[model samples]
Structure formats: C-alpha cells, structure tokens
Target: MKAWQHLQREPGSAVADPDVLQVINACAPRPSPTLMRINGRVVIAYSRTRAFIDRDAWEALPSDGLLLLRVWPRGTSSSWFALTRPELERTFDEVRKTRSWNSVRHYHFRVFPAALEAFRVCMTRDEAPFASQISAAEAGSESEKRGSPVSPSH
Candidate 1:
C-alpha cells in the first residue's frame, strides 16, 4: 500500500506509533509484518461463509481505519479477488461493495486493537482458520430442524 511504500522510501526515519488493522486472506501462507505499523497488531484470517470469525475482536473500529490487507500479489492470488492499485487506495469502500445477501467476505479489516483473549480461546497454534465448512452445512440443517416459517435465502 501507499503507506508501506512511503515507509519503505524512508527506511531510517522513525516510524510513527502504529494505528493498524491487519487482514490475512484466504489460503495465505502467513501475515506480513511490514504492513502492520499502525496499531502494531496482526489480524491474519479467513472469513467463514456466513461470518467474520474475528468479528467480536474488532467490532468497534470504523470502516476507514488503517488496514493491512494481507493478500497475495505474486504468483496465484490467495484472495477470492486480488486487489488492484486503485482498489487498495479505497479498499474499505471497495470491500464494503462486496457485501450481499449471503456473502461475508470483504477487505474491511481495518482497526487493530490489542488482541482479545476471547478471540483466541477457540484457536490454537495447530488449528487452521475457519477449521472447516461443516459448520455452514450444520447451520442449514439446524434451520430445517427448527422448521422456521421463512426459508433461508440461499
């Protein structure tokens, strides 16, 4: 991003206190630390089909807060949609545009607050993000079991 480019240009200069929000894309190998100058926290992740698993971790940040979108720009892109230069400039806005009736993916990973224990409780060093898609199917089954009057849109 522009901020990283700016910082890269001035390697010796004292970087400002971080005000960052991090985003790790799907199938990412790892989160990049260079993009995390603002707020100085990492938020590498993949969103589940129906939810942002880390939602409560940063529920209070605004859409435009600083972000470190950790997507692949080399080789095959790990993100469902790789961001272009113009899109990165307005990533939050562009990501919000991806919102729809059943989609939970977007580039709106701005705001890097200190890590929350609640957010880490379910995850461990060995577990992978989202873990699996069985939950999505389970949700549908549960809905059927409840016999809700309105059917799911999907």
Candidate 2:
C-alpha cells in the first residue's frame, strides 16, 4: 500500500486534500501533505500539508535529506512545522521549541529525499532570503501580514 493509504487508516485519519496530494506527488522525495485546522484561525495554509512517520521509519531512511512536518492548533486554523535537512532525530524536540507548537494538538512529519549538501545550499541561498522577505513584509504592516499568509506548519 502507498504511504498515504496507511495514513488514511491511522486513528485520526483526515482526508488529505487533492491539491495537497498533487503537490506531494509532483515534489520528489516529499511525503504527502496532511490537512488540519486549529482554533478559528487558518494559521497554516493548505499548501503546507505534511506526512508523519514513526521514529523507526525516520531512522531507516537515508541520512541526507529534507523532512517536512505539519503542526496544527487544537481548534484554530493556524499551524506550522519545520522542513529541515539531515532528518530530525527528535521531532518533538524541535516542535517544543516553536511558539506555535505551544498550543498545537496535531502534527505529522514528511521526509524528503535530498542530499544534505544540496539541502544546506538551498536553505542558505534560497530559503533564507525568501524567509527574510516574508519577515520584512510581515513586520512592515498588519495589512501586508494579513494579505501574505504563512505556510502551514510542516
């Protein structure tokens, strides 16, 4: 069975969105995205869905790669997760460190097949600048922040 099939059978099985599934399929090495909602706000958007895996599965995978995790609020729409290279040894460790994770009740990790070297380069050269831009825009004004939605936790 596909990983997604197994996910659907899990205890909290929420239907993965079609768009999310498409992105996951098109993006090599990344797991299918998981959808979730928190409080009343949609903190995490649909594009940020992620897959969850057990520790054993995580450890068995290749060492050099990117992993994406999605976290959601208990009753709101806001949620987020980390996408990092060099598989996270402990998902909870990083989650606990984030402000949004403080109130999160649901989450999953999505592993990506990427070389550590490439991932590092991408993060430093690509993602870092993009993140800075978003931060700057968000800091500039409430209107801009509201207009530019943050990616879902993952």
Candidate 3:
C-alpha cells in the first residue's frame, strides 16, 4: 500500500543516508511517526514541493519487490519512466528521443534497482547552510563562489 509516512523528530533508523536522515534531524520539526516496516511498498517524502526517499527506508524494502519510478520535468510535458529490467529496454528507447537533462527544471525518479543503486552511491554532497545574517565579507565571498551577486542582507 502507498502511504505518506511523516518523519519523526528523532530518527527511527540510522541506516538512511545522512542528508535523507536530515529530514528528521534535530534542527527540523518532526511531522509524524516514521513508518518502520517496508511491507509491500512504502514511501517517505520531505515536502510537497520536492523530496527524495530515505535510504534506510529504501534498504528496508524487500530486494525482490518490483519497483517503478517516474520523473517529470518541470514545466514540460515529457515524463521519464524506469521500470524493472524486463521493461527497461523499452523505456530507454523511449527516453533517448525525449529526455534532455539540460532542460530539466525539476526531476522525478523511479526507485527501482539501477536508480536506487545510483541514489545510494551518488547522493548530494554537503552544501552550505543558510544563516539569518551574513556579513559583507562573507556575502562577497559567497557571491564569488557562486559566480553571482550576493547582498549582505540576503
């Protein structure tokens, strides 16, 4: 069954990747109890705008279970689908003609084997945290790093 499991204030599991784990970290408010069982199928989302699955939650999934992931490009009609192996070849043939990474504003991913493995090994690296206040020097440096203008008040 598909359900939206709300994250807890404290993590129910440590096996999830740290960034994914951060969805329930001390700094963030817990929305609800985490689903511990991966029976059949389960999914966890961060917010309505954008989210990815928790690795620990993914790990709990029975390996043999079938997975299907669909990604939609923001402001575009084209959608990407990745099904289990037997259906993958056909999906790829379809993807080649329509998918363009450079045009993607937002992406949706399917959580089957190859995609899951990629998420496991290629999750995002550490990013700078946002602060309530930024000094002139800090803002200037950040602007240089991003190759864009950053104001101290930002």
Candidate 4:
C-alpha cells in the first residue's frame, strides 16, 4: 500500500481532521495519489517531484499554519505550488511540467520527515510535555550560544 494510505488508516490521523478536510475540499478536483495531509494545526502538502511551498511564502505563515513540514526522500528542490489569486492555476501548470522525478523524491523524503517523526513521537506519549521539553532545550541552547545564562525561575 502507498505510504499515504498507511498514514490515513490511523484513527486520529491528519487525513481525518476537519480543517484539513475543508482545505482539501476547497482545493478542488483532487489530484490522483494524494500528496497532502492536514493535521489540526499543520498542513503537509507535497508535489510529486518538487516541494509545494517556496521559502518566502513558508516563512510568512503564522506559527499556527506551519505549512509543508516535510519533503519526502530528502534533498529536494522546492517551488511555490499555491500562488496568490489569479496566478494559481498558471503557476501549478508551470510546475507540473518542469518538476523532475529526483526533485520530487527528495521533497517526499526530506521536507516531510520531521512531521512524520513528530507523529510517531506523538503516538507514544502526551506530546505537549515532550514538545515543551524540546522547546526549552532549544531555548537553552540559543541562550548559551549568545553567552547568556538562563535561570530556572524564569
């Protein structure tokens, strides 16, 4: 079975989330072999041979959106699949024609890997605590690098 199919089988899988479903429905005329998955707060969209979002657009998403987490296979080239307004369809068409197999594979493996890892991690424990721990650790590291000391009380 396809990886996407496997992911969809779980009860709380992102595939079943209402928000994601809404987005998928709005996106219209679903493409074959689904390349996107939406969890409560995040959206994972893939392109067969390229990444779905460009860096500038990605950086613009609010923390809540967290769009396009992983690209499959790793080391993939990325471009914007969803353009603003009038250019959307034309941009998608341009991408469909220019994307390569290797590029797509890289996107599938790399960009989405972190999200997949997070899902696996979430399945094992109360993800909020773990996520908090990770955030704390990252903040600590950042503080250290800046030559600042973090106090436990803070």
C-alpha TM-scores of all predictions:
0.21, 0.25, 0.21, 0.27
What does each candidate score in C-alpha RMSD? 18.5, 17.0, 20.1, 18.1
**Candidate 3 residues 19-103, lDDT tens each?**
3333323222122213321333332322121223223223333433222222323564321211223222322223323344124
| Better-scoring candidate (TM-score), 3 or 4 | 4
Report lDDT (Cα) of residue 2, candidate 2. Answer: 23
lDDT of 3 at 121: 15
Give the higher-lDDT candidate: 1 or 2.
Answer: 2
Clashes of each: 7, 21, 3, 17
In model 4, state the lDDT of residue 48: 41
Winner of 1 and 4 under lDDT = 4
TM-score of 2: 0.25
Q: Write the per-residue lDDT of candidate 1 for residues 1-154, one digit (tens) a residue.
A: 3231111111111112112111221133223112221243332223222212222222322333322223334454332221222323332232334453127423333332111111122122454323232354345431110111211222
Q: Rank the candidates by lDDT, best first.
A: 4, 2, 3, 1
Candidate that would win on lDDT:
4
Model 3: CA > 4 A from native: 1-57, 78-80, 83-154
Which of the two candidates, 1 or 4, achieves a greater TM-score against the reference? 4
**Candidate of highest TM-score:** 4
Cα lDDT tens digits for candidate 4, 13-87: 332334543553444321122223344443433234423433323323334452322222237542212222222
Cα lDDT of candidate 2 equals 0.29
